[model samples]
Target: MFGLPRPVKRLIVGAPVRADGQELDLDVQLLLLMTRLENGDLAARTVERARRGLERGQIYLDRRPSRPVRTRDVDAGGVPARLYTPQGLPPGSPLLVYYHGGGWVVGGIDTHDTVCRYLAVHAEVRTLSVGYRLAPEHRYPAAADDALAAYEFAVTGAEKLGADPEAVAVGGDSAGGNLAAVVGALAARRPAFALLLYPATDMTVRRRSRELFADRFYLTDRAMTWYADHYCPDRARRAEPAASPLLADLREFPPTYLVTAGFDPLRDEGEAFAARLADAGVPVAARRQADLVHGFANMWPLGGRFVEALAEAAGALRTGLYAGPRGRGTTGGGR
Candidate 1:
């Protein structure tokens, strides 16, 4: 179970219901429409809508304030990734390497750019977002390999970027969350932390939430199956920790922040992974966005609460990482 200590009470989350979820979450409604399109068995149109629905974050990223950061094209597991660094970093500053959520098929740096920027500035750390190749082209373990390469780059090549190689943290949302967990498993307690946002830990389709929320939840069973199928063409490979870290026995994971959406089908899996972490004696803190849906981190344009949720999550990150060096200074506040 997720232990709550003091402030954790204020940060606790509640589960979301369908009817009340309708008000004030139009993007979710639109996304639900797009998801239904995905479930209609129309591959071309569904993928097209998925692409567009994923782009809805553009409005937020566009309006987000930009800062001075170098974009260096780097290689990761044969995939290309663009690294971002804030202006004028003194040596030994911490670094955060991130992966974007697209359920393994859709997103890249472009989709997750603004959120990355806010994280870089807010956490007071250099944040690098990975541009791993998507599925239906590059399948399972491909993204994980890219994540490891990016992690290696951050750890081994820190001097060139003016960051502490030892202080790097791995994080991501959705499928990226899976990558983060598996990366931590591979790194074996090297990075300072692992921040996961509604990670898909199990590629298995038989989960209770997946069955119960087959269509009603913002993310449905059919869409999840679509993503898993695209990423895991080889049925046997799906059992690997890279594809499903929740099934893999992991020990000595880094200190972790596992965030989940209460209404998400992936919620149970993320929570389960956190429990496994603690059971394995890995330091962990799990936060569930009870009132939010999956991918609410990208809901900046939805309203103030959405942005506040991001702030809260980032604040938790800062608290978990920099609790001593600095005290609770928030960045990325312009809404």
Candidate 2:
């Protein structure tokens, strides 16, 4: 199915899917169906198999070659990371330390390369895509620890990475977003900004969206539970601020731009966190992509609404990093 031509894929997608008062993007519906046909029952797959499947799926969906961004392998603190710098970008530009989403287990640098490239090119900022340790192997707090270390590295070693030390930011999608929120709250020095995409903010409780879009949305509830069990087997510990940053104090968090998909299981929690940040007097802008699903960041190459949504996020990222402080509020738009 993934091997089909773009037009052919659209033909197969047939019609948009409507559920719970919103219509899912046709491209997203097609991708979810293909994923189901390609890899059935994600929770039943072995960890290695799940990782490979996610990487393969991302590569297939995001087929656009690298843009004008120049990339280099670098060590962020002790964590391996890839640094992307857009062509002709001047030194001392802002830097975004990014983490990839895979429920803390499946994704890596290769899986999220296209996303970083898009941000580097569109947002016009230096991007360091962190390759953090995975779970069920490294387990709880390992990824979080690496996330903070990488952010510190980006701050302290910004000159070496060709970025402005004071303008360093943290951003990521899904589980990576959780890490970004954790780093935002726990970092010794606050980041200049934060970009969280459909973050898994609170792992301790399943919000309504979790139950509403539990299946057929690219990210299933069973798979989420599987991920949580592997990443943090101690159920009680899931409530820790490191594991569930939504519960953390946000008064000192940096200005943030958070985007959530209307159909994603993590949607409600991400919005809830944004509301908490605003109530804490932090500057925040939250947007809901009403016609999308989880993992839309990797689907931008599909064009149409996917690209439009991501482009909005890129614009917000640019503004957050370059426009200085902004107002705090919740805003909604999509489709």
Candidate 3:
């Protein structure tokens, strides 16, 4: 669909992959090529430069009109947030508090506006996209603090924003996913569910995937190390469960859906966290996009595969947050 040559398509789908799963999808390969050609090493760029670069790259996606949903900017309990509401949504539909991914440094609401709009429309839920303070300025625990505050705001102030407090969920991608994990654990009352897409659950130590896919995937290990350094300059804070949620007590977490990418450097840690959540008696839906790398969720140019993954995530949101409670278990693309 991305106009990949037939031979390149065959090579992409046929390439031998890591022990975790299958080869890269042709669409992802094409997107990676385009990304490599267009962007520079993010790790080497200043935060402002990196942010501008990402925002500029974001312009390539077809900026679909949000006719089906209405968007507004608002203060989410002292944190700046953008709210997206599906047009004509019934009373008491589920509400999702979303966090954007950028290694806790670069991205903000504008960078992830499309993702929030997609969820609001496809999931038929209202979404609040938080623009938490960034790293190297706000540093360790600032974003976590903002996440907890935003969730609390959504839960307590849902009615004011035309949503149901009891139906509120929390989610994010990469660094934002890590924040969701932390918030899901520390919140006074558990959320309906947490949708984590290729999350960075553990920053305490490097996992096998980090070493194996260090430079092969879209998100390189070097960039990750740089991100971690900027976010949590103190190594001790990095080990804290609030910072590295994979080390947290997952027993009390609500229904959780974790989406990991087979080619992502963070894959193993995300899967391990899912296993830990299941082990701790939390209902889980874990899926691994064996043919995609980290951040595929935002690479709209890749087409249907990424859209299908988002649909799966939306389905998980509907099933987990809307259905009645049950025993701990998991179902999806992974164990």
Candidate 4:
């Protein structure tokens, strides 16, 4: 299926991660740890474990860099976020208000610093990677609120960051993708496109795919449940539009390009969200990534396809954002 060279194929599938709990691999161990955190009575326990995990730098997002990295911070309005600007500055280029993915719990700016630099260099754009406060510490609206706040800040302060406001967009993978989707919805009237990468569209956790693959998939049912629990502490938060963008009406979303990994547990929800968006007359382009598992975007060495993915994303941005002939806002004539 994936016509990669011999060694790369093995890398794609991973080293046969065993299902038996005793023979757990890194993800499985983390999965077990997260499960414990979710069910525990102590709130700080969960937050501390997540913080420790991030600090360890042993998670899926361990991509290394080969560029001159510049660090800075912007008020995610009130939410805190660190921004990474890559080497080889491209003046007045498009900006990506990126939200890092860790099911909204485990990831932050430092963990994702290399990946952001990769995107900025490969896509030739300025990416403001938002470190919106993690969940199980902050609830639903907090991260979503931070995503939007960062976006507005980018819009208001584009010149200072050396980005063009007219060419700005929003995007993320997993939880960040969900944030990007909701951010697009909330700022529909704003001049921006969306580059969603395997977004968690539905928070209800009722998709048949999840049920079927719960026990065995790359993204185990246990892991998904754990992620959701951490992202939404109380029952009420899970149902909110910020936490569950799929539950919200999609009529007002911006032009979007949603990417889904074929083997991911969230595949069905991403597909469903695309359907809903199209049904609501929103322009949407979804690419299904076959021959890959969940979290491939963050697995650079394993998949080695992040480079190609970055190129595709750049092309999508060109089509979605602009006043050019192929841009979304233009038609045969004006509306």
Q: Which candidate leads the pack in lDDT? A: 2
**Deviating ranges (above 4 Å) for candidate 2:** 1-11, 65-67, 326-335
lDDT of 1 by residue, 137-226 (tens): 788778888888788877888767667666778889998888988888876446778888889997754666666556665667777888
Displacement of the residue 183 alpha carbon in candidate 1, Å? 0.5
What clash pairs does model 1 have? 14-290
How much lDDT does candidate 2 score?
A: 0.87
Model 4, 53-137: lDDT tens per residue? 5456345455555666577887757767666666665556677888888878777887667667766665556789888877777
Tens digit of per-residue lDDT, candidate 3, span 72-158: 998988999999987777666778999999999988998888888877776777899999999989998999999999999999999
| TM-score of every candidate relative to the true structure | 0.81, 0.92, 0.92, 0.78
Q: For candidate 2, which ten residues in a row score worst on lDDT?
A: 326-335
lDDT of each: 0.71, 0.87, 0.83, 0.69
Candidate 1, superposed: residue stretches over 4 Å from native: 1-49, 56-61, 66-70, 87-89, 324-335
Lowest-lDDT window of 10 residues in candidate 4?
Answer: 326-335
Better of 1 and 4 by lDDT: 1
Q: How many clashes does each candidate structure show, in the order listed? A: 1, 0, 0, 0
